[model samples]
Target: MTDLDYFDQFDDEGTEDSASKRDSLPDWVSNSNSSLAAYQAIQSLYKEKMQYIRGHSKKSHYTKKGSYHISKSEVARAAGLAKPNAIFHSVDYASKLTKELNDKNALLVASKEKILLSRSSSIKDLSKKELQSELRGRDRYKEISELKADEIVDLTLKRLPLDVKRQLYLA
Candidate 1:
């Protein structure tokens, strides 16, 4: 077959697959004549996009941006709607979904910030030796924590003056 014909065959197959997907949709979505179905589709698409943003799904077509929030246009395109404004046809439903999406995005940002803060605080608490070991790709924290009390006492005493060591042992 010619190159054009070959590509056209794939295009036709894609349409058929999409048609099958449409047929598989629930009755409320596939058979409805109302705009509610469109809103439902948009809501579901938004949720799917959020799943991609949250790294819960492997199939991601959306570009990675600094903001985690999904736009109305993105949802409309995912739902195969002609215009982004179509998502807002049902104002109440659209507003509710938008609020929920914003809340979820805020929570995700907050959680990430909390994780970064915890990591920074833990790093700051590390001793110079532990930090150097960590930079050398060694996990010193576990080894240090696992050190025996007697070993720690010996290590501490080894740094003291002879008189101090003698006095400490006498006491």
Candidate 2:
């Protein structure tokens, strides 16, 4: 059969007496008669073309030829977005974001632990000079970490809801 004749089969089986078919159809399908058979015919026309998303590419990362992994952040950067790891498209992008966030959180925890560890003695027992030295060390680390934290905040701001990020910023 000719390609043009292909649609004739689905159309004919669907029925000719449009009014009679309306009586047999369900309420939703019957109501669509206001648009004639256009919607139904189109749906039937592309039945084979419509496909469920089975899966995305399994590749762990996309690295341009001879280059390091092009992270989601990098992709967004290339696309001229303001932050990294902010866009979500597939499972891999979600995985990349999870790893980056978890890694940074662990660094923050480690820095806080270092400060706690530096205070070997109780504050009530330390000499004034020794206390100053310890405080200086903690402040140095805190300053460096605050820079990183700000970077993380910028990244998170691009991805998170504004109100949620506002609370984090205030805290």
Taking every candidate in turn, the Cα RMSD to the unseen true structure, in Å, is 11.1, 27.1
Q: Could you tally the backbone clashes for each prediction?
A: 0, 1
* lDDT of candidate 1 over 56-154, digit per residue (tens): 322122335434455666666666777767555554355654555466557655544444345433676666877887777655666667899998887
| Reference-based TM-score, model 1 | 0.35
lDDT of 2: 0.45
Model 1 local distance difference test score:
0.57
Best by TM-score: 1
- What lDDT tens digits, residue by residue, belong to model 2 across residues 19-120? 776676434333422222322332332232121111211122212311222234433444455554343333333444445434443543444445434643
With candidate 1 superimposed using the best TM-score fit, by how many Å does residue 128's alpha carbon deviate from the native? Answer: 19
Global lDDT scores for all candidate models: 0.57, 0.45
Cα displacement (angstroms), candidate 1, residue 52, comes to 4.0
